[model samples]
Target: MPYVAVSALSHNGLIRSHNEDSLVIGPWTLCSTETESPQTLLFPLGTPLVVAVADGLGGHPSGDVASALVVRRLARIGPLLDSEEAVRDALTACNEAMYASADDDPDLIMMGTTVAGVVMLPRAVLTFNVGDSRVFDATRDGLRQTSVDDSPPPAPGHRTTSLVTQTIGGTVEFTAVHPHVTSAPLAPESRYLVCSDGLTDPVTDDEIGEVLRVHDDGKAAFELWKAAMDAGGPDNITLALVRVSE
Candidate 1:
């Protein structure tokens, strides 16, 4: 039998006043939530399961609103995401929905989010992203990024940048997106990390890999959160550790 397990957490970090990161695990979603401890969920490998994070654009009004809308929409459509085209269409719909929502509300204009996550099928996993959030393959070997970052190369001494070339919705006008989509065969065992940049921006990949190597899935999720908090916790942090076993 094949099964999937996800351990996740979200926090406002030390510097952020509120958590603008939202997450969707299957049909369950979290919005503007604070969760210091790792919460684990299990499911049989059947319907397509989406594990993703949405990071609201900082310095923009109603960031939380944008992120929540994106994640909730994903949760509603997770099971229907069975193919690459389906995933792409869903993301496109999400982008359009952002603009639609913004149009209906004056304050929501110029609000947007960066999204990244994995869609786990029975025998394969599809990884997708927009903006600079990330999905990574995690194992004893190390962490390998599976999603594309939409920002320019970081300057010297910087791990990440604040400027994003594309996002869900940041302006009043409609902006199309070419989401990065890729698929890999699911092995007898595999693990993936889907997270907002808040986790990756402050913590180095080496540190994250070390924690994953030393800890189990659930504990690794907690340790990763702690590492970000220890490193000044500059932004909203949200993450999920997904494991598939047969």
Candidate 2:
């Protein structure tokens, strides 16, 4: 039988004071960790498997708290995310919980996070995201972004924009999110990359593709993280590589 494997890592990056990012793969979660080395896990094919990253919104209070909250929720509900609607409903619950947390605390107002990842089903994979975090179809041929970015066009000479159009929870008033979710057949040797903007902001898709072409699995993950650090690692870095193997 085929199986799904995920190699994940998280770091605060060079500029960030601390890691506000969080990760979830099935029932496991990592919040505010400094894991430059990749940690890999394997899961059987039949059950639902979720691998995701939640990047806490920068320049917001309790960004860490917000990200941690969402990823933990994802971990708890991972096995049930077999369809797009299930993923959407889960995100809605997370958004509501974010707002409810803020309402109960004065300092956590406006806390928010961007999420992106893939859900591995028996025969297909679902890619989903909100805000600027990303999901990518990584193959030897090239790297293709599967998740839609919620940010507008950047200014001249700017590689990226910090401003995002939507997120899980960014305001005192509750805001709904239109998450980007797409499905594709899950063939053997299939691979996907899920990450916060920390990896994409400084590194170009072409550069990332080059790395994927040359390396694989944990090595690919490490090389990508190195590329971001070489580019001056501006924000909290978190990423995961998912592959379906026989």
Candidate 3:
């Protein structure tokens, strides 16, 4: 059977005092099974795919906690399903998990994170997001964004960016659940890049595509982060590269 090759890393950028970004790669068992060892924090590459990045709300208390909780919830997903609906359901579980954590900690109220991830199988690619963090499809023609930003588009005469209209734990209302989820067929020779705004906000899509085109997936992920840091590294940087192979 063909397998997905996944590699990821998170860093505190030039400006941030600490990295609030979190990532989850590989099976949930790996995360839970080695709690007492350093391996608890890392996962091996071969298995049904689950790779994601979470950017904690910058101003919120326990922002790192919020992001880590969300990714951990995703890691816990077992008996994994490859369909789009299952992906949505999994996200819902992440939302609830974040909320439950917030409920326990007074300081964490309204705390949330931007989540973007991909579930890949030989037949398809299911991509999702719940904030400005994004996922892109890299094709021979170029890189095209796959998920829509949950934030509103920049308005006329407005110079600054806006917040995500939907997120994992922004509000208590049930209908506030993020509606920006979509999936489509994975193109052979096509490469998927899932990242937090740390990378996109600083680097151009063309640059991202060019890097992937020139390097292997693991190196591509690293080069992308290096470029962002070179460009001043304004925020936390993260990138995940998943290539569909023959």
Candidate 4:
């Protein structure tokens, strides 16, 4: 049987007054404003595993609430995610909950969050994302981004990308979230990373690949966080690294 080793970390970063990021790994879950020292878990290969990260949209009221709602919903729905349809349904339920909450409170109105995660089954891993938070596949070939960003590409001669086009609870009007989802066969020597934009905004893909190549699961996670902080930790950083083995 294959086995998976995982490590996760979340930090408020140097500039943020609060951390509006949430995460879940297997049975454990963390809400916004909660920080946990890096923790490692090992799962027997055939067991189902779910890991996720959510980043609250800055400049919005109760951003922490929005992000906390996302991961908590996923944690509740995690064990039952046995198929692609099930995953979609779970995400829809989360979206609806966010929308309903926003409708019920003026302070939470227009609050939104980005979500990215992976569900590991016996044979394959399913990856999904909404907004700019991401999932990446790391192997000897290179680091490939598996989740698509909802933001538009940067314009000519400009480094700035467009704002996120899709998210949970960004508006009070009825809107449907279409998450990007994909799957890949679980293979030895491969690693998957689920992270908030806080990590990617400061750390380049090549730099990420280099760190993954040089370290094991826990160390890689720590190094990634370090790199982001070294780059000034402009936002809240949250990530999970999962490594597969036979």
Weakest lDDT window of 10 consecutive positions for candidate 1: 181-190
Candidate 3 segments exceeding 4 Å error:
28-47, 155-162, 172-175
- Clash totals in order: 0, 0, 0, 1
What value does the lDDT take at residue 114 in candidate 1? 90
Per-prediction TM-score to the true structure, in the order listed = 0.98, 0.98, 0.85, 0.94
CA shift at 241, candidate 1, in angstroms?
0.1
Instruction: Report model 3's TM-score to 2 decimal places.
Output: 0.85
RMSD of each: 0.8, 0.8, 4.6, 1.7
Give the lowest summed-lDDT range of ten residues in model 4.
29-38
How much is the lDDT of residue 89 in candidate 3?
A: 84
Evaluated against the true structure, the overall lDDT of model 3 is 0.72
Instruction: Give the alpha carbon lDDT tens digit for every residue of 106-179 in model 3.
Output: 67777888888787765677788888898888767778898878877677865326577878885543334654
lDDT of 4 by residue, 110-164 (tens): 8888899999888889898889999999877889999999998888975546388
Which of 2 and 3 is the better model by TM-score? Answer: 2
Error of 1 at 130 (Å): 0.5
User: Which lDDT value does model 1 have at 84?
Assistant: 89
Error of 2 at 101 (Å): 0.8
The superposed Cα distance between candidate 4 and the true structure at residue 147, in angstroms, equals 0.3
CA lDDT of each candidate? 0.93, 0.92, 0.72, 0.85
